[model samples]
Target chain A: MSDEKRYLKLHLIVLALVVIAELIGTKSYKLGPGTIVLLPMLYALLLGLLTGPKFLKIIDKEDMNAAEGLITVSVMLLMAKYGTNIGPTLPLIIKSGPALILQEFGNLGTVLLGMPFALLLGLRREAIGATFSIAREPNLAIISDMYGLDSPEGRGVMGVYVAGTVFGSIFFGLFAGFAATALPLHPYALAMASGVGSASMMSAAVGALVEIFPNMAEEITALGAASNLATGADGVYMSIFMALPMCEWLYRKLIRDRAEEVIKG
Target chain B: MKLSLKDPVVITVIVAILTLVGNFVGYKIDPITAFPGMLILFLIVIVGMWITKIMPGNLPAVVYVSLLGIILTMPWFPLGEKVAELTSQVNFLALTTPILGYAGISLGKDLDSFKKNGLRIVVVAIFVFVGTYLGSAVIAHTVLKLTGQI
Candidate 1:
């Protein structure tokens, strides 16, 4: 009856609708594991787009923010669940240290492999900061502090950060699922691959693995969670001490030729 | 009657209820078992959030919750096995459905920003994924081969 209550009711209704849409989308399709991994996300995005700015007209801003804030709870629950799953496998995870280390290398590889293309695309120097860093929530803070948020490098990183936040999970989920099923690699390796720091991406990646290898889901989830935790803890230092400088060097090398071309023209 | 959804207390209560309902419906576990499992999860998250808030460095809530979960459910800890058994029925994958759904909606809000970044951003993201996947894969492959895991 009260305004607050009314707004809350409307928000719940909208959320129910979104969830129903996702359910229908997922249930109606008989897509492969990769597509199924992404179906809910795709449906949510499509519903959000279709509903668009108009939904804003109905839902109050504060209430909308509140709804978004609830996402943290979901993430926390998912992490807790993941952590519980990892408990029994603690010994195994410790023994798999080499694989975990390799996963970190792979995480660093994103910057190594992404920067050249970023530079070739004429992203400018600042983007190197963004491209080189893993671009998760923590790295964003480190980058912002080291090179003020307004700096081009800051903006570049922010762009990728946003892109990663938005698409990272979807991409990782689809890729991990596809890789686990199609590649010759071990599922555990793919599981380690899932822990690229961002929780959503990790969840999506691990979820895809579950769909593909149901029997190995528990081990896979546990390994992925461990790898992700390691990335989060060690990744901060790696980004600051190693990735930033490495990316900068690669960016200059890649961009210098383009700069010379511009001068000659 | 005048409870604001923005209130943390309100949100917490709502989340606890939703998580319970979600576990029940999705996992199809009996209420007695499900309630305790959900309660443990809820407490873990709350404590994890508190720890993150008080911790010196910028520890993410995910890390805290995960660490807490691991510790509480460790084989050495009292009630570890029991909690693990109950929590395992919580249906983590079911929980992921709504989380990913919310992530999608959140992504939708950023479509314009993404569009502004151009196709280049997509290329960079792809490379980010490739670098991560390949970097991990190459190392993992070597390690597994050496250890005879494959």
Candidate 2:
């Protein structure tokens, strides 16, 4: 068989398996809302791991890239739907602008809080770039381009990027669900909390929120999407202009044994 | 004509069809009702992709599609109500499943890379997750308090 044919066959097989797994996992399992929300994702991850390099020959690098590309369509649709939902609530969403700004600060807070640990852990100065940024796909690209992927900073960023890509959704979903139920915060506030730039993580967090608050699902989703968009557009610039410098400054002040010089982007 | 899985055009078409079919089946919407919204979605995706190409920097396609969706469905626009009515029923949860599935699989494929980063990466990831979540939550809490939205 031609390579194309083989690739197509593998793609179809994996997709079929995934759909089946999702159906079975969701239907049969009587787990809690959080478990239910995460079931399909876990199933897919398990299937991929079983068929991945160390095990079988079902999926390869090329197939993975193709599958990743296909997800762009899903993301676009998800975001577009979010946009439509936000339409009716545009005025209210706008009025809640302070919350959105706060959300961005919170996103920045992650780097601020994470940087100290990264430096204390003896992570080189370059690692600060990756650790300080949001560590989404675009940030990964920017870091990789600025600091070669083989550099300590690149490794640090890629490590966070990979971890975020794999586990970010699950964490976000569970965290949002837990926060919504456990905390005194409003569901809409929790909803806005879901949008930390990564689309998949946002979806998972919103999904969990929907399970918890079905009536407010639309609002939660809209607010989450809007927050996500803001993070994506503004977060990048913020990371470059503000977050990176702040992290470097913190490292210099706090870390006594800082050897490597900070690479200004 | 031969279809190549590697061809982006072919991949896009396949994905579009699968998503449409998935939406209809998963959401159990009537084909007639779902068709218009699906068409609009497709147009939005295509246009979003084009916009991403021309736009400077790495502005995500989702941004454009969402922006466009917001604009088209805004109350001021003539077709806003109609478009909103048609697309409102498009259940996003059903749409997120397959995408998350793909993401899971892709993560598995990159397991080696993840392993290479070692356990310290896990620590960094934890901090990253905690910092972002807490930071955002604190801010959201304060704002909600000030605005009396909570």
Candidate 3:
């Protein structure tokens, strides 16, 4: 009947189709592929397309909230199962963690890179505000509400976080690669090498290594297999654990109430 | 609709059962394959939201889809042989959120604006980066050194 209603129906139809596909695929072929398409990257693109530049503006008008129960529960479940692996995974985590943390700092570096430019652009308020504000990540939409990135200053802080996350990956990945070569360690270096490359990059590296050293391919794959799985899950965990919460806490203290007032006025 | 954890839990249980059966009935079909298959199923469920237009855009669709996707795919329950298989396969690198987060953040449309404010953002990100890294490093090297782990 109404335009909005019609659009809603279309979205519903697409959802139904996806469900049906999953059911049939599982029952019949027992396989699932290309599911990576559902990553937050896709969502960010979608939000950008639908909401445009004002997207952050709209998100800012909302109250800071997060799925406190769900996130905490999910992470708890994950920790319970994966926590023990701490012994085996710890060394790797530490080696990678430093790089990861550096990447986070490197991200902050990117934010600073933008700071003076913001002032120069005469969008100082937005610049200053954006600097500390946690910019929205489309995937973060799920838990972002719980954290206070919804506030102006929060958004400003988020802007920094968002920037950091982006550069952090490349820096970390690159760092990992370099360290792997420079260091004498095996697993740690290999993992770092793998880290610098995205999934695809790792895949290529593995393929090339296997090709060049055919005898060692299986060994390399065996060593890498576990990390591959962890790579898939860890990113999600850190986002939920470290990134989103940090954004929320900062926003709540500095900008939450003020944002609501601004919105009301 | 009111949110409840019941559905996810139930789904997880059902998957556990299926994994067991599959391991028993079809010896060739490993949990790993089935794991991805489960992710595919989860993704499909979200497609319904998209079809109905209730799904706002790609991002929401992706988030809901992946959350459910990983749940379905991750081998929480293991059949006899697959039990050890899943355990050995689990590692830190398998946790894929950071790279995915990076990809998402890098897609920000406000890069130009962000670039303009470059100094502040970079400084903060660096400070945070150093803080987190150094803190963790100290804990690992100093705290865990005696354990011979780090």
Candidate 4:
């Protein structure tokens, strides 16, 4: 197919998916301790996946290729929209600047929590790539550039990047909403937390928050957008300077400790 | 992505048109009315992308784009306030459906590789995401409360 025809086909599918998804609209379910909020974004995502070459095979691989570059573009536009949300709330962001800076240190929790579990699960060197950071596109780039993609580190990073793209946003969406309902924290706090830098994940997370707290949509979105931009800005350097090394040190320690225990035995 | 200068503009126009349909269907706004707001966002993003392309450092284009958007719409900017009012017609969430729809469509290329990576990595990855999210939330909550922002 011609370039025009191919893009046209892919877009038509999206247009249809958007229409159907919006029609179904946002739905919330009460299940035990939390609310599971379903969003049009979810439907659009899953249906778009199903229509891909792997499943129903409705579109071409080239069409999928077209979709790839556009992810960054769409996210740019969305973040630009987020930028608008931030201006009016600039004072609040400045006041909460300390919280924003401190919360990013919370990112270290990935290595802290993930590395030990990965050791227990027998992940080895791959754990360094997998657990060091959130392992989104930029993090994946860092891993590949540092340790060539053929390395174990490469496989570890790729594994998570692939898996993350598939399920990250959907998980964020559901989990954020559930946390908002289940926890005692303000929706604004949860909103600030929702910005993980990765566009789909942050937006879906914010979407869920807005769904549950309709009246606070502006504040929730503004906070989420600011937090997300901060995460993205800090994420690249922090992962390189901090996360990767921490993962490496922890991995070596845990492995050596295990070897020591074996020697004692 | 290989691009001539016009790519952002072309893509923006296309996405804006698509967003118009979704905005009308989902939000009950007329497509005619929403198009102008969508165009405003498209202009900001295009300018942002241009800034990123020429800027010396490696900051993600999103930040620059966002900064520009923020500047152009700030209340004190006078003209920015009008930009904000026009753009507000297109809900920010309206932008997600198209991008995510694109994300989903592109995912097929990676699905098999994901499967090959085995279930172990997927499980650990889930932990990676969960840990970052939960930890960040707890800290943000504590700090917000301490700071009395909430």
Candidate 5:
């Protein structure tokens, strides 16, 4: 098929999905103190997955590749949309206190809980990649560059990167929604944490929050955008100097013979 | 394969138009009403990507797009309020629908790689996402309470 014909087909599929998802509209279920809000975005994502090659195979390789290329471009527009939200609320976000900057340190939670658990799960140096950071594109780039994606670290990062790509946003969406209702945390705080240094993940989490706290939609969107910006802008440096090194130290402390294991296995 | 600037720029325009349909259906905003704001945003997306293309280094286009967005919409910018007003009519949720729809369609090829990652990777992947999100939320909650922002 001609490239134009292929693209037209790909886009038409997406258009139909978008319309159907929007038509279904937003649905909210009350679970505990919080709400489990299912937005059209999630439905659109799931519907796309159902039609994709892994399941229905509605789209061919060329279509997927073409679609993949569009992601970066499409997301930039989304960022632009969200970025406008930041300007008017700049004062509020900054005034929200040191939490704006301090919350970034929370990224370390990955290694804190993930390291020992991944070790318990029987993963090796790969734990470093899996636990060091969220394994988004930037984190993945760091690992791939340092270890060349063929190393244990590379495999570890790639595994999570792909996994995150497929399911990470959905996880964030559900978890964020569930936590908002199940826990006693304030919506603003939860909003800030939704950033997690990745766009889709932040969007999913923020989307759920907006559904639950419609009153705070403006604040939720603003703080989430600001926090995500901070995380993304500063994350690469932090991962290289702080997070990666910390993960290495923890790995060495937990496993006595890093060299021996690699040699033996 | 290297990604040239052309494809994404074209796709951005396509998505801008696509988003209009979604905005109309979901948000009840007429396409004509959302057109101006969408045009402004579309221009920003293009200019931001263009800046990244010409600029040195490998920074993602998003960083530039985001920074430019903040700058152009800030109070000092002459058209900031107008821009904000027009764009506000275009719902944020509307923008996300097509983006994820595209993402969903693209997910099939990655499934094999994800499956090969095994159960352990999936478990660990969940841990990583949970840690980042929950950890940050907890910290934010604490700081807000301590500082009385919440």
Candidate 6:
């Protein structure tokens, strides 16, 4: 196939991957094989390869740059949904809310575990951007240009994002499992926790959690739906808050000075 | 095996159908139950893979499958009429959770290589996540509370 055809094909494949992930993760199958980790990663890797060369070229395109807008819409919608959903049960959800936020904090508390893994897992960072980009819109060309995923830093962070995605799932999944063992909490809490990053992964996490602990299955579904809406609503503002400083620090500490030296040459 | 997966059009057609079909079937099934929704999702994915001649891999794929299974299925599985009622009352979470996660992590992942400079970036992520969580939670709670909804 020609390059554009190939590119189009890749984009389509990525979309398919999303669909497949959505299907299997949303289902009730147990021990039938298939999990969340493989599908999306492969899709992302394929996306990266397809768009690697056009990364810079994509940046030059004008109307195609919808990164900011898309992210904003996605985040707001997610948060609004979450907030509105819990609006009725505010008292209970709030009583439980601190714990919910704390649970997230505890997961992040593992920054000790996460940092080293991130340092080594080169693809996670870019994958973070890529995954978000895809969620914003499946336009590979636009994502490539906006994030410059071809950059050394971009590549490095993609590694971190992928690793984070995997780790985040397992960590949260296991947390849910253990929590279920000890507490009166429900699986929705777990799914909500997992959905903290990628919806696809969160969907998978909720599916698995419900299957193993069939008792809490209902709670899990409610949480998953709630999680999606919550994240979608506040996601953009959160992104700006988190990404700006982190990217700045990474660029200054990792990418900038090196590029500066190259420029001087 | 690899050749089938490498085919882009095949992958796209397969996914689009699965997504539409899954959503359609998912809608048909009562989101209050788990089995039917889960089954439909599983069928779509496994069949999609089979038709595309691809197999599941380690880690990420496994997680994806497991997660998808739970998410799609739980909605349809009979979790008691309570779950059904509760979920319907709170379906807005569907949109918020995913959006926050996608954007938050997109930004969060940028933290990689940032640690090479020491604890500064990690500190930033901590503050950001905590601050945002609190900020959002406080605003959310206040709004709900003021409306006498809380």
lDDT top scorer? 5
Q: List runs of model 6 lying over 4 Å from the truth.
A: A1-113, A120-146, A160-175, A178-191, A208-216, A250-265, B1-150
Worst 10 residues of 5 chain A by lDDT: A28-37
lDDT per residue for candidate 2 within B63-110, as digits (tens), equals: 676678778887888998998888865655555555555555555555
Interface RMSD of 4: 5.2
Which runs in model 5 stand beyond 4 Å of their true positions?
Answer: A53-57, A115-259, A262-265, B1-6, B115-122, B133-150
> In terms of DockQ, which candidate is strongest?
5
Predicted candidate 6 versus true structure: per-residue lDDT over B43-131, tens digit per residue: 43453334334544422122232233333324334543333243343222222222222222233233334345224333323332233
Model 3 per-residue lDDT tens digits across residues A98-148: 433333322232233444444444433344344322232322333332333
Of 1 and 2, the candidate ahead on DockQ is 2
The order by descending lDDT is: 5, 4, 2, 1, 6, 3
Pairs of colliding residues, candidate 1:
A106-B135, A106-B136, A126-A153, A130-A157
**Model 2 chain B: worst 10 consecutive residues (lDDT sum):** B92-101
Among all windows of ten consecutive residues in candidate 1 chain B, which has the lowest summed lDDT? Answer: B99-108
Per-residue lDDT tens digits for candidate 2, residues A112-198, read: 778777766656654575567657654644454445344566557757765675567767777888888888877877777778887
Q: Comparing only chain A of model 1 with the true chain A, what is the TM-score?
A: 0.63
lDDT of 6 at B50: 48
Interface RMSD of each: 5.2, 5.0, 11.4, 5.2, 5.0, 13.2
**What interface-residue Cα RMSD does candidate 1 give after superposition?**
5.2
Candidate 1 residue A107 Cα shift, in angstroms, is 2.2
Where model 4 places Cα greater than 4 Å from the true spot, the runs are: A97-101, A115-265, B1-6, B116-122, B133-150
Across residues A1-265, which tens digit of lDDT does each residue of candidate 5 receive? 7777777787888899899999999876544333345678778878987887667878888887777666655666777776776666555555545887899999989998888888888888888988899887556546644554445786677677657866677788888999899999899999999999777778889989998999999999988988987786567667877898999999988787656777899
How well does candidate 2 match the true structure in TM-score terms?
Answer: 0.64
Candidate 4 C-alpha lDDT tens digits along B1-150: 665422757766767777777788888888778777777788887887788789896656655776787788766787877788878888765777786687678767766654555688888887888788787888988998898887
- Chain A only: list TM-scores of all candidates: 0.63, 0.61, 0.35, 0.65, 0.63, 0.45
